[model samples]
Target: MTTLTRTLTDTQVVAKRNLLKIVRVPEILVAVLISPIMFVLLFAYVFGGAIDPGDGTSYREFLIPGIFAQTVVFGATFTGAGIAEDMQKGIIDRFRSLPMSQSAVLAGRTLSDVVYNVLSLLIMALTGLLVGWRVRGSLLDAAAAFGLLLVFAYAVSWIMALVGVLVPSVEVINNASFIVIMPLTFVSNAFVPLDSFPPALRVFVEWNPVSTLTQACRELFGNTNPAAPVSDAWSMQNPALYTLICVVVILVVFAPLAIARYRRTSR
Candidate 1:
């Protein structure tokens, strides 16, 4: 078999092994899912009243997409934590002894985490709908929005994977991801309108990829008000394209770095 085919086959085997853990340890799936649902309910009811999205859009409608973006990004930490757990428990050492493709372990870990994020997203979507969130756009646009979120999340998983391989500690990876992701999601237009940010911070919010992802979702889901004026910043103006670019750039930069780190750590 060609190298590419070998890698793919090995990766699938590794991915299946990782996925089976979910079935055996169902609490992992429960923990993975509960946070997003809690966020939807808390934001939709608690902060939902205090926040104004303008454009006559209900806060729940505006909030759900942001929650979606934040949850998926946060979900990427699973990749890091899972890898760190494996490394800490000598699972990586066992994998190294196998004839499997070296990159398969990392690839499989990331691919399996995508399934976790998918399940999380589905639960969050149901929670959002129960709380009055609606997709006002065509089915195609909604699908594209969800696709963009997943792709971006996948790219982010590579970065986390690099950290995981480097640290090899589940707690450290989870805490580190929290420190970075909290600020990225909060400072963006994810939960609030762009106008709510101060001028200096506004620039960052406008350009922030998290903001772009949220904007892309809102636009595609028809959550944004047609009557409301749009942000002039190029990223916000072209969020879908910008988000796609971010995904490509992240994957390009981090995938190799993670793979390289894994090899070195395995050695």
Candidate 2:
């Protein structure tokens, strides 16, 4: 078999192992499905009225995409934590003794988490609809929006996989990832208007990958702000393209780094 085929076959096995853990442990599903719903409720009812999303749109509409973006990015913590747990428990050593592809372990861990994110997205989409958020875009466009989210998420999962290999402690992964992810999500266009942000801060918010992801979703879902001035930044002007670029760059930079860490640290 070719190298690509060998890697893919081994990856499937690792992915299956990770997926089986989710099936055996019901609570993981509950927590993954519940938290996004809770975020929808808390933000929709509590802060919806407080945050104005311009004249034509409701805060609920604005909040849904932001929430989705935040949740997916936060989902990376699960990837990191899983890897760290495996390392802490010495499961990596056992995997190393096998003759499978070295890349399969990290590849499988990240790929399995894509399923987790997909489930979270579906649950969140249903919850958003129940709370009166609608997707006004064509079905194809909506699918593209969701595809962007999962793609970006899949790429970031590799970064977390590296962190897991390096850190090897579940508790530390959570704390360390939070310090990095929290700011990226909050300081972006997720929960608030870009106009309200000062010029200096707005620059960063406009270009932040998190913000572009949020913009791309809003445009695809037809939830954009009509009253606000049009953004001209390269990132905001062409969010879908920009988001694709970010995903590619993230994967290129992190995938090799993660695989190297897995090979070195797993042994």
What lDDT does each candidate get? 0.91, 0.91
Q: How well is each residue in 160-255 modelled by candidate 2, as lDDT tens digits?
A: 898889884789998889888999999999998888899999999998999999999999999875666767898999988998999999999999
Q: How accurate is candidate 1 locally (lDDT)?
A: 0.91
Each model's TM-score, in the order given? 0.98, 0.97
Residue-by-residue lDDT tens digits, candidate 1, 75-127: 88889999999999998999988887999999999998889888988999899
Q: After superposition, how far is residue 205 of candidate 2 from its true place, in Å?
A: 0.5
Q: Candidate 1: TM-score?
A: 0.98
Clashes of 1: 0
- Give the lowest summed-lDDT range of ten residues in model 1: 258-267
